[model samples]
Target: MAALEAEIARRPGHNIKRAEQALMTAKAAVLREFELTVPQYAGMVVLSYLPGTSGAQLARICAVTPQTMATVLSNLEAKGLVTRTPSSVHQKVFVTKLTRAGNALIKRADVKAHAVEDRLVAEFSDDERRLLADLLERAIKVLNG
Candidate 1:
């Protein structure tokens, strides 16, 4: 623990990366119980909020390459959780939506995911959580810019 703290103190990015890894590990564990990968889970969550989104849009939103998103969508389609249809507005575009099965699975998965989140934040006050979120967002914005 002391060595880890010392290393992270020397490189702050290590702290952020480690935190992200831990969060992803926890999420993956919960998601696995539902037979979903992290990307698939993320895609479904996005679809729940924005139904009929384009594959390109989902790829951007999920921070994955278009090819990776295509594979994720294909896997979800094979699992009968989502469907992709040719867009009426764009002949070459395919829009994706969560099927009823996807909706139900996500609803259940969210409960488990939220439990992991709640456990992660259990030691923090509400204000601290907000501050952490803001700082993370700012770091992302700076890195992106």
Candidate 2:
């Protein structure tokens, strides 16, 4: 245990990755109740927020490859949670939108997800939460660059 703690203290990236993995695990467990995977739930959430989004755009937003997004979109479609219609501007492009059922499912899932998030940051003040978000975003931007 001390060794693990020492390693974590020495590597911020490793610590962040471990935290992310733990969060994903907890989220997966919550999503399981709705028969959804983490990727599926993320796709649904994005679709709910941005109706008529393209699969490619969704892939970027979800930080998954286009091929992976295709699979996730397929699963969501099979579950009747989303629909894809050919874009009016581009016949070759397909636009995705959540169905009423998808919207409902995401709403419930959001509640559960928020509960998990709240618990994770329960000790932090509002300012601390905002600061953490800003710092994470800056790190992501640097890494992406």
Candidate 3:
């Protein structure tokens, strides 16, 4: 085999993009009963854990368009999962947080998320998983830079 083919074969069976797709699919399957998109579910979970968050902050954290965040906020609001409190001083700024329902949703999602995560990294040892994550993070920083 060519050197490149040999190198490719030495790499993990599932590439990053394929693994991401599997993760999204797993999460979607888990969230199907909740009638939520992945973005909405993730946004709500973030809000639940981080109080006094803003829509702009959420957009950054979730790495999505502000327009997408707006749509997610709307959906979450409709589902009674998230709430936005207007700033008394700055009318343009809103503080976002998760409701009781949102917290509950995250708790449920966490179970399924863990299962998915375990399955995804099953082939790798704990140290390998950590090393893989660190390498991926470094690559992401370099790409973003």
Candidate 4:
């Protein structure tokens, strides 16, 4: 504990990266069963709720680059999990929607993802959980600024 604290003191934001790596690793392990990467799962979850979302919008929501989102969408399309078409309102914009398979997969995968979230907060009280979430969001806002 002393060594970890010393390291964290020496390198601010190290713990954030460590936490992110740990969370992503655990998430990847569970999502592997569903044949989904974290970004792919994220994109699908958004599409499940907001079908016909433009790719640019999805990229921004997912916090991924447009190129990365494009690849994710392509992979999902190849898997028959999603479809992309020219937007009705904007002919040049490509919108994405989950297919039946994508919807079903996200339903199944969401349970596993929630399990990871539950495990992450298992030791925290509800208030603590909320506080932690709020703190992370605040950090993101500050960093974005």
What would the TM-scores of all predictions be? 0.90, 0.90, 0.83, 0.90
Q: Which runs in model 4 stand beyond 4 Å of their true positions?
A: 1-5
Question: lDDT per residue, candidate 4, 84-129, as tens digits?
Answer: 9898888889988899999999999999987998899997999999
Q: What are the per-residue Cα lDDT tens digits for candidate 1 across 48-136? A: 99999988999999999999999999999999999999999999999899999999999999889889889999979999999999999
lDDT of each: 0.93, 0.93, 0.82, 0.92
Instruction: Please report how far candidate 4 places residue 74 from its true position, in Å.
Output: 0.3
Clashing pairs in 4: none
lDDT of 2 by residue, 1-145 (tens): 9998897779979879988999999999999999999999999999988999999999999999999999999999999999999999998899999999999999999899878888989979999999999999999899899
**Model 4: how far residue 124 lies from native, Å:** 0.9
Better of 3 and 4 by TM-score: 4
Residue runs of model 3 more than 4 Å from their true location after superposition: 1-14
Question: Alpha carbon lDDT of residue 14, candidate 4?
Answer: 86
Supply the global lDDT for candidate 3. 0.82
Q: What is the C-alpha RMSD of each candidate to the true structure, in Å?
A: 2.2, 2.0, 3.6, 2.3
Could you give candidate 3's per-residue lDDT for residues 79-120 as a string of tens digits?
A: 888888997768988898888888888788777766776787
Candidates in descending lDDT order? 2, 1, 4, 3
